[model samples]
Target: MELVIGIDIGGTKTKIGLVDKEGKCLEDTFFRTKEYPDIDDYLDKVVATIEELKDKFNYANILGCGIGAPNASSKNGTIENASNLLWKGTVPIIKKLNERMPMPMRIMNDASVAALGEMLFGNAKGMSDFIVITLGTGFGSGIVANGKLIDGFDGFAGELGHIDMTLGDGRITGLGVKGGLEAYVSATGLKRTIMYMQSKYLDESRFRSIAYNDLHGEDITKAAEEGDPIALKAFDYTAKILGLALANFTAFTQPEAFFLLGGLVNSGKWILDPLHTYFEEHLLEVYKGKVKLLSSGMEGKTAAISGAASLIWESHTDEY
Candidate 1:
């Protein structure tokens, strides 16, 4: 069976996997991304891990490697100014990896690869246009239009998270941006919204029992599940903001659907219902009720691995 290596680089951890063309992950493992402050050291460890996997699998049909990372650029094959990562400045990841392994390798933003995976192996299999929104620690987005990923001029176009909403009282994002969609709709944003609701409702809020530092998105989710008014309100507020943003996004791309991925999406109806409601309410008449709001069919390591592998598959087939 033809195989490829998929590497997903995140803020805290990096997951590496051997994936087949069928989207099956044969073997997978991870390492702490922050542990290796030196890029070369990290690359060395990655190379060693790949070699270990190759030996264990005893497979020689490996096609190439595809990496998905924050601030990754397909045009440059580099990770540039990634705020969440420990690396400083632009790192030529493809070049460094090729020096050791000497095979075809490609890289792009994590969300973009996820979108590609969705198109090839998940919910978007037959769709020609769609958007994937990753609601992780931070918000990330990938846009596919007319069966093509929109990389824009700098290969960094689908930054829907940074779309300014002009929400004057919005929470600040890790990038220190205020009023960005990520500041109000991501996991961190959920926590912030919960805290705000706790402050607003005070004694009447169950969240009052939870300390500020101890509060988490999971806590709010649990609370919402248990019918906590404050928690539900937090979800409502977050969805309203997100819906508005997505509605505006629709005006631009008019995709057939929008797929939600990541932890916050686990809240299910607590977020989706309100999001759908407000999205339609805010959408332009021509676009209303046409765009579908869907959950990602891919999840966990499978999604990441499949996405990375799909990158290589697409590259090999000259699909992008």
Candidate 2:
């Protein structure tokens, strides 16, 4: 069985895995992403880690490397201006990795790789058209049209998160975009909504007991599950914004479904129910009742690692 090295670089940690073709991670490990201030040093550590894993598993005949990172470009094999990472400017990740490894390496933004993983080994199997929306600390999306991932001109397409949902004068995103979809729908967005609701409702809001810095999405979710009015309202408002944005996305690509992935989906019915309701309400008549909203078939570290591995398989089959 052929194996691939999969790397998922996040704001805080980097997960490396040895993944097989079946979307199974045979071995995995991690390191703090923030700890490496220099790109070369980071790559060196990654290579060393992979080598250690290889020796431990006695793995041989490695296919290649597949990486998912923020602001990564599949076309250029580079991560450009990734605000989350400690590195500045464009980092030629593929080039850097290839220098140390014998096999080829490919790179793409995290969301796109997740979509590929779904297409190859998850719920999206046999589906030619779909969208994967990741609702975590931030919002991310991957669009698959005609059975191909749309990388766009700069390989930065499928940025559904940055869509201007508010029209104008809305919550500012970390990207400095005002009223961006991520500003209202992501985990960070949920916390912001909770904070806003606390201010508006004052003593009437249950969130009044929580400190601004201590409040988290999990807290809001817990409260919503328990029937807290403010928490429920926050989820409703977030779903409304996300659903409308999804509705707009449907009009453009008309995907068969939208798979919601990541931590926010754990809120379960609290988010999905309102999201489905608002999505249908906002969708165009021609698109209404056609597109399906569903949760991701894959999750956790394995899902991301599998997605990264799938990129290697995809490259071999010309399916990427």
TM-score, one value per model: 0.95, 0.96
Candidate 2: RMSD to truth: 1.6
Give all candidate RMSDs, comma-separated: 1.7, 1.6
lDDT: worst 10-residue window of model 1: 311-320
User: What tens-digit string does per-residue lDDT give for candidate 2 at 130-182?
Assistant: 99999999999999999999999989998888888667788888889988889
Query: Compared with the true structure, what per-residue lDDT tens digits does model 1 show for residues 62-97?
Result: 999989999999999999999999998999999999
TM-score of 1: 0.95
- The clash count of every prediction, one per candidate, is 0, 0
Residue 151 CA error for candidate 1 (Å)? Answer: 0.8
lDDT of 2 at 293: 86
Off by over 4 Å in 1: 167-169, 317-320
